[model samples]
Target: MGLAAKMDAPRIDRGLDDIYVKETSICLVDGDRGRLVYRGFDIRDLAQHSNFEETVFILVHGRLPTREEYDMLRKGLAESRAITPDLVRLLRRMPPDAPPMDVLRTAVSYMSNFDPERDDPTRTANMRKAQRLVAKFPTIVAAHHRIREGKRPLAPNPRLGIAEDFLRMVTGKRPDPLSARIMDVALILHADHSMNASAFAAIVAASTLADLYSAIVAAIATLKGPLHGGANEAALRTMLLVGKPENAERYVLDTLANRGKIFGFGHRVYRTYDPRALILREYARQLSEKRGQEDLFRIAEILQEVTVRELKAKQIYPNVDFYSGLVYHLLGLPMDLFTPIFAVSRVSGWTAHVIEYWDDNRLVRPLDYYVGPRDAVYVPLDQRS
Candidate 1:
């Protein structure tokens, strides 16, 4: 007999799918309408008009920053972009073969020791630390990449904007206007999604009243999972493995035949196509054309077509991960750095959620319904023998 039949109770576990844990003003994810909103502003508007820094400001604060506030936030981020020498040395000493996400997780944890307000959970202190993490994560990711490649990490350029500076740090050259804008929009699109795994992890840790760094570390660790942030990396590699546009159909057929996942073709929440994917697909196409690498985009498109044709009946459509890999590649980033870039963008949203959760914080403890071997007596090793 099943547990439900024997115990007279139905199994209610669903991984908390479709469960609304709490209300949030930071973002609105309308999966049905294929829309995303941040602080009451449509993502489409923000992507077209706002930069990453400005979007982040809106997320952390409840409103768009005025020119004065914008300048202050920009200046603060620029000033905080330099990681400590000790942090650089520590990144250098870490196992050169460690996954970039693991390095990032460790770096955030290590940073806690250096925080003067590590024990202080005051709103001001948390906000200050959030600014620091937001500014420094990109630096940490770039430093780790350079260290693994036996190159000295570049210092952040205080004069450049966040997207431009991050591109420079990663590639040692200032990006052109189109590339910089693409990166900026990419960052804005990724800044937040309601109750995602990483944000949930951050919120759970913060609810325990842990330090901000610890909470972000929890977020990063959760993002490292393949099912979450790593999907884009997998999607890119899958496209590369297919090798040509002509091979995409075969690849999809074989994967489907074997019951393997097509990583970028579906999302848990979105009923239609993801709005971010819709935005990024255009950028991916334009960027690949600009870079004279249109063949890669062609293959991605063919695969997208096949995936949709095969699965549209089930509402399995492309998510942001589908085209974002191509965009990052066109931006001259290695696949391994993709999730770290995700972290760099998403730290803004993570910090915002953590800060907001503190207003009426509660521990996120859920009880499991036990139905296995209840009321059994304990057996000692000798008795068992």
Candidate 2:
């Protein structure tokens, strides 16, 4: 018998499906309609008309920012982009082959020690911490990449936006205008999705009145899991394994026949096409053309075509991870760094959710029905079976 049946309890939501924990105006994810809205603006509109800095303001403050507010936020992010010398030394001492996500998680936790407001939990202090996280996430990721390659980390250029500065630091040169714009749009697209696994993990930590850095450390660890933030990296590796466009069909059929997963093709929340995937698909195509990666794009196209043909009846569709890997690869990032880049974009949402949860915070304690045993009498160790 099932645990609930044996315990004579009501059926539990195994994954907490369709459960509402609290009200939030930060984002609306309409699975049925394939719409994603941040605050009050549609994601598509934001992707086209706004940059990551503007989008961060919306997610954090709950509305569009005035000119002065936008300028101040941009300035703060620019000022916060540089990691300290201690952090650089930490990065250098870490194992070169260590996973990027683990490095990110540890580095963030370490940097918490140096935050002037690390012990301060006021909304004002948390907001400053959020800004520092948003600004420094890229720097940490880029610096780790450089250190792993035995190179010195580059300093942030104050004149550049977050996206441009990240590309420049990682690559040791300025990015072309198109590439920089694409990176900015990518960051904007990924800024937030309401209460995703990583975001929820962050909320759970924050619910206990943990410091902002502690809560974010929880999020980074959660996002490191394969089913969460690692999908893009897995998806890209699958593409590379397929090796050519013509092999896409056979690979899809073989994987389906064995009941194996196609990493990027499905999502837990989205029933129809993922709006972010739809947005990135176009950018992927454009970047492919510009970077002479047409073959890679064609392979992705064929995989999507075959997967959709076989799985459309089951409501399985391409989600954001599908094209995001291709975009990151075409933009010159390595496969392993894909998820760290994801963290770089998603820290905005994670912090926003944590701050929102603290507005009317409660300890998130839930009960689990016990089914293992009924009041068994304890025995001394010598008499135990």
Candidate 3:
């Protein structure tokens, strides 16, 4: 009787099959098939040959920009590097303990207030917004860190590439060329992965006719939760807390015994491996070699090996987070700043998503099942008494 009654109720949870927006993109990922393509070209091809600005142009305009056009975009980026003084003052006023994601979420939303073209979503406007978002997000990130440390924010250097300029602004020194190149490739690799959590959130919000900033703010908020963008920070923290490679197996066992989910091992979408993870594993390894820090490298490698064996036995696999924290570590980012750095590059993809949604949007309203009493009424309290 109980089984029959349970079977009578409708399934309330949807796997949400419609969330992935299939576009005629050159960007493609066949996870189970272990394939990744971008702009009718493979990622490996792009990583070998293309830079971040080139990749960003590809994602935005659906074709590589010509040299003259690329130069114009670069100047537009540099010319727009500095944030308003008003924004700086507000950032300085924020509490030192505020999370960087929160700072970015709030600051980006606040950016709309100053823009005369904020309401325009025509192709021209979106193109401009895309450029502004990609250029300014790093500034916002660096300001949050510097103001909290009671240090002045450094200006973005026009001469530097995106990764080097970002590192220079945040760390107040230029990075080694190899380290910067690795970081740039990581950013390019991470720039898009169709309809992931944050992208979906932004699209759903945009479907409701929200402004670009509103859509982006909601997406950043979604990314702040542990199940999504926060996992990399969790990954870094897990490594730090474990403190040694020999302790990792015991730590995993204890964590599993406590029924705690390991941060970097499992993913929702991928079956065999995350393509981005493979890309970043190289960067992490390269950086460790360059810095002659074999211990850090060995610790990461052991953790990766142990995680792959245990998790595969449990039918799980390493996701982007697993390798990304190691890359960020090698690139000399503070643990706390890992996810904000993710935002710096992902803003390009997010802008692309919002633009796509605005072109052909419907309100993202879905039906819900009502489980309340069919016909219930309230009685006057005094009368009932």
Candidate 4:
């Protein structure tokens, strides 16, 4: 092709919105019908019946684990849950006020130096790395939370599952059965969404044949963007500002009148309600009642009612972010830790995608149509403009 023809080539899919880069069987997101299926299991069923460890196993392995397989997976995760002492010292050295997500991104990159299989690219090694990542993410987030709070990090309890251990480490108290179960379900819900920004970012990095940790670093950085993973924190702040159920209508009306986004009410892919949000809405209600924060839940309910009434024609509805923040708050998590908690769950999905993509790896280079001047005359060093 000539330069002129190339330069004038029509652009296609500006944001890759209509593109299909690869085939995936990890998760299916049916936006029009409001369904989410992970490895052919409906999200509602998984949330109701499966634990986080089991859910993660299904995502990575593509089938329900046998009882012996489940035991091994659990044991692997538990054994890998503790961070090295050097990592603890690094966390202590980090700026106390750094955003937890930033800290997490850096910490994940640092961990690559110590991975036993860092030099190996075999499928078995990658699977082991994936398991280690899923296990340590909670520990990393919780340890950073404690260090920033001027408290010493707690050692992992080998007997506890990921959700229970994270809660125990972060709060220095053994989680109640209900709170632990809620945390487990929350993890399962956030474990993956098909072709979301961060997961795509992970696969893109992996396409370069990068190591698992490096690809996860890319994912974490991408997820830190407000348009992607930070919505839950922003949404929760808006709810707190509303402060009472009575204020919700005024808040929503004014925000809508000013054409400001009411965070957590819409999604890029879902034209109907987000199924994850539907599951979490009930949990938010239950936890709020238990924690004596029913007014906050009431505020959310009012916001949802008004927003749906006004915007249902546009197909706008509550998304996963809407109730997730409330659930985290009622579980005693701080606001800044919200997005990090998202990473804690999503690392499972990220690694799964990375490993799967590597099975038939290809470079993900896309072309940008050049629009600059074609034949600019070169000027001598002393030539006038």
Candidate 5:
């Protein structure tokens, strides 16, 4: 081979950006058109027409549920909503200053100890475990937030749906119907998105035949990374810092000039405006108006326009995080709990991927191109000089 050909022969995909590592039937991320799909259904439809419980059922079971099936799933979620009393005491004892994501990771790990099916990888058992996780994660998060705020965690109200129950638990008051609807859509939007980092992490753990809780713990740890799942928190902070619509342009220009990342404006996958962001942009407006925070929403709008104008040619556009934080803020969620709430939604996707991984499982071991010297002689310590 020519030298040029030799040099090109082993070009490994750095970061595996375009590499298709495995096949999945759970979700499809249409990066080109910025659409997200769950089991052949458009996320926009699911977000508009379905609730979190239904969307999660579709993701895990690979189809929409019949009314009986839907009712069963909802009943399971409702019945399993209470965390163990031991978990509650543990939550109370945890460091109040700990990062919510870290606390969530540890909590999931601890929860596995109480699971009767902790070691069972059977499909039925895994599904049952998934039901418990979906039910308890919001409770865990709200409880943690409550403890840190010097309030006792409230028991979940089984009469309400997950969104309303979580809101009530965290804020000590039931969310209005519209706010609950917004929260439901947010959960559906975040439920799944192909094999994002956290799902990939869960799959890797499952590829090793680890238990479901361990796999999800892996996913939670991965999602704790700022680059992967913390973008919404950072994005909201940016808008908060910018403070007003008129100041957005200067803030973006200065940040870009300094090579600082403007979080929420770009994605590794989507080349077009993110469909979730499109839906949330409107919610942010309406909810902000309701909360008398029109100025805050306007700042986001200005930033969106400025960034889109400057970066659209590069195919860098908003990807879900841009408006989500604003909505969360209007809902009275604390800033630190933002990513944990992401976990609350994404656990459905992570467990779904893990369950699917075992169907035709293989270890996810990839080779790296080594660059260091291959041959070297070791010198005795006495002869080193």
Candidate 6:
């Protein structure tokens, strides 16, 4: 082996900037161009033209479906909504202070315990589990939250889209139509990215031929980092610190001066606007009008402006995290719960990717460039003492 080939150290948690595996389909992101696509369809077009259910179908099955197939997929999602009564019992029993993501993790773990085919290694069985998880995730998360909050869980409202249904479950009231549509697009935008950290973790775990649940567990751990799924929660907290629109620019500058990486500005992927940021920006606008929180909207606008100017000065650009937290705020979600809600959307992608890996499983072994000191001869145990 060449000197370069002899190196063998782990790829520690430094930022990875290259693709190391083949994926059949993905949400294509041109980070420099600020574009997003699912399979071959652009994110902007999909957000405008599609719903979460259809998008899930596209992600899983690798194409947009005909009307009948879409209907079938929708029905499957609907039918898969119920968590086991025992699952509900378990959720209610979890301590109130338990993190929602932890609750969600337990819920997915419980699913494998209850379902017979959950451990099956075959693609058919794994796909069925994937469909169930994709279907039930929002239901489980929302229901678990409500139950913990001492409210009765709302059964899935079939009349609403998945986003609306989730909101209905969460708030114990129907979301306003415009608000629901905005959130639908938000969920669509968050659904998947190509080989993101969590997705890669899921693929790596499954490449070991572990059961899907085990793989998903590893993925969730990766996502729990503040730099990843936690970004939205951080973004919202940052806006709250600014207190109002007029102060946004000053606050951003102060943060920059403090050498703080303003959460939501940088991304490993997008070099320009995060496509999701644009979708959520529309949501923020709509909510501003409906709720008459124009000041909050203004704050968000200023923040966006500041993000661009500051990041440009620093040679960075806004990523999806930049504007999404404000939309969640305008939608009246609890600030801290933002990342948990992200897990609710991202579970679909994680499971889908895991199943994909299982279909053509291989241990994800990679060569590394090690530069540590060479192996030294061990001293005799007694002599050293």
Question: Roughly what TM-score does model 6 have, to 2 decimal places?
Answer: 0.90
Tell me the lDDT of model 5 at 35: 82
Clashes of each: 0, 0, 1, 0, 0, 2
Cα lDDT computed for each candidate against the true fold: 0.91, 0.92, 0.79, 0.93, 0.90, 0.80
* True-vs-predicted CA distance for residue 151, candidate 4, Å: 0.3
Model 3 C-alpha lDDT per residue in residues 1-385, reported as the tens digit of each score: 3565567776665756444554646357776755677667677777889888888888888788899999988888877878999999889888889989889998998898998887886878878877988888888898778889888998778877787888877877888888788878877887877777788888888887877877888778877877777788788778777877788778777777788887887666567877777887787778878887666667667777776776776667667887788778877788778888888878777878778666677787767765566567789888886
Give the per-residue lDDT digits (tens) of candidate 2, residues 232-326. 87888889999999999999999999999887987777899999999999999999999888999999999999999999898999989988988
Model 4 RMSD in Å is 2.1
- lDDT tens per residue, model 1, 1-385: 4756667765685777857877889999898999899999999999998999999899999799999999999999999999999999999999989999999999989999988988888898888898999999899999899899888999999898888889988888889999999999999999999898899999889888988888899999999988899889889999889898889899998998899989788888899989999999999999989999888999999889998999888999999998898899999999999999999999999999999999889999877766676568999989995
lDDT ranking from best candidate downward: 4, 2, 1, 5, 6, 3
Q: Estimate candidate 2's RMSD in Å.
A: 1.8
Instruction: Report model 2's TM-score to 2 decimal places.
Output: 0.96
lDDT tens string, model 6, 31-142? 8888888878898988999988888888777788999998887888888887778888888999988888788888887788878886688877887787888778888888
User: Listing every candidate in turn, what is its Cα RMSD in Å to the true structure after a full C-alpha superposition?
Assistant: 1.8, 1.8, 2.6, 2.1, 2.3, 3.2
Q: How high is each candidate's TM-score?
A: 0.95, 0.96, 0.91, 0.96, 0.95, 0.90
Q: Which has the greatest lDDT? A: 4
Score residue 206 of candidate 3 by CA lDDT.
86
Q: Could you give me the TM-score of model 3 versus the true structure?
A: 0.91
Error of 6 at 277 (Å): 0.7
Q: Which stretches of candidate 2 lie over 4 Å from their true place?
A: 1-7, 374-385
lDDT of 6: 0.80
**How well is each residue in 238-320 modelled by candidate 4, as lDDT tens digits?**
99999989999999999999998898998878999999999999999999999989999999999999998888899999999
